[model samples]
Target: MPRYEYRCRTCGDTFELSRPMAQSSAPAACPDGHEDTVKLLSAVAVGGTASAAPAGSGGGCCGGGCCG
Candidate 1:
């Protein structure tokens, strides 16, 4: 299973859910029972070593970024 981030457009709430990849884009109601929620196009932290960079800092070096 993969974790996904979603934002509820109706109630302006953000939440996460773990589901199969096939359900990544499925229409899902917010946990708060709001139906006008939509999946947010957000970056998921997959397998990798964690870093201490500040939030929004590019993760590559050598003129690219840190993560590169």
Candidate 2:
């Protein structure tokens, strides 16, 4: 299960919940029992090393920013 961040509009409190993706969009209540809460858009981070391209091998002028 992925954790989701939510904010209560009534009491202005932020909270988190661990639930399934299917219920991610469902309504959530804050710790204070405020039902006027909204789900926040979270940023996902992906990590990995990308292989570099060979030297002098690219789309030419545009790739090298030679187009002014």
Candidate 3:
């Protein structure tokens, strides 16, 4: 199951729910019992930063002493 973000047009409430992909865009009742709701775009968890060094950089002090 995938998570989806939803916003309620009636109560102006925002929340997330885990449901099947088929229900991703289905109309869902608000937690406050409101029947009018709209599905919002999902947000990314993180920026996906790379922590390791790039390939072919080599294990040297300054690119094989080019800067030395």
Candidate 4:
């Protein structure tokens, strides 16, 4: 299951729900009893251990040096 963020248009309340991907865009009701909720676009972050780059090798494009 994937967690989805929803925002209620009527009450301006936001909430999260874990459901199947097939229902990602399905209609959802807000906790405040508002049915005019819409799914909000959210970012997903993937994390990993940072490793040092080899000598003379170009680091990450951002130049943060987190080139693993």
Candidate 5:
């Protein structure tokens, strides 16, 4: 199951629900019983330890910036 964030247009309430991926896009109602609710686009984040930097890898321009 995955958690989904939704917002109600009628009552202006926001809520969350846990449902199967198959029903992720299904219609949902707000806690205040507002049926005009829409799912919100949420961000996903992954975390891990930073990798070691090679020696002599000082402040050199990378492709990420214009300095690359």
Candidate 6:
């Protein structure tokens, strides 16, 4: 399941919901029972390690400082 952010125009409140991607475009009501709501744009962050470059290398243009 993915989480989505929403804002209620009636009460000016923001909320979140966990739902399937199919229903991501579906309308959602606010906690205060406000039907005038709109989905908000969300940003995703990815974190990981890069192993493309070997140790003791500058990892430059060719990952081996060859372009220098």
- TM-score per candidate, in order? 0.61, 0.71, 0.60, 0.67, 0.70, 0.67
- Give the per-residue lDDT of model 5 (tens digit) for 1-68: 79999999998888999999999999998998889999999999977548856555655556234373
lDDT of each: 0.81, 0.89, 0.81, 0.87, 0.86, 0.89
Q: Write the residue-wise lDDT of candidate 2 on 1-68 in tens digits.
A: 89999999999989999999999999999999889999999999987548766655656796665677
Candidate 6 has a TM-score of 0.67
Error of 5 at 66 (Å): 13
Model number with the top TM-score: 2
Q: After superposition, how far is residue 16 of candidate 3 from its true place, in Å?
A: 1.2
User: Whose lDDT is greatest here?
Assistant: 2
Residue-wise lDDT of candidate 4 within 1-68, one digit each (tens)? 79999999998989999999999988999998889988999988987647856555656555655656
In angstroms, the error of model 6 at 51 is: 8.6
Ranking by TM-score: 2, 5, 6, 4, 1, 3
Return whichever of 1 and 5 wins on lDDT. 5
Candidates ranked, most accurate by lDDT first: 2, 6, 4, 5, 1, 3
Name the weakest run of 10 consecutive residues (lDDT summed) in model 2.
Answer: 49-58
Clashes counted in candidate 6 amount to 0
Candidate no. 4 TM-score: 0.67
- At residue 16, candidate 6 shows an lDDT of 97
Candidate 5 shows a clash count of: 0
Tens-place lDDT per residue, model 3, 1-68, is 78888889988999888999987878888889898888898657875448866754776766555564
* lDDT over C-alpha atoms for residue 64 of model 6: 65
Candidate no. 1 TM-score? 0.61
lDDT assessment of candidate 5:
0.86
**Over 4 Å off, model 6:** 49-68
Q: What are the RMSDs of all candidates, in order? A: 8.9, 3.9, 6.2, 5.6, 4.7, 4.7
Query: What lDDT is reached at residue 39 by model 6?
Result: 97
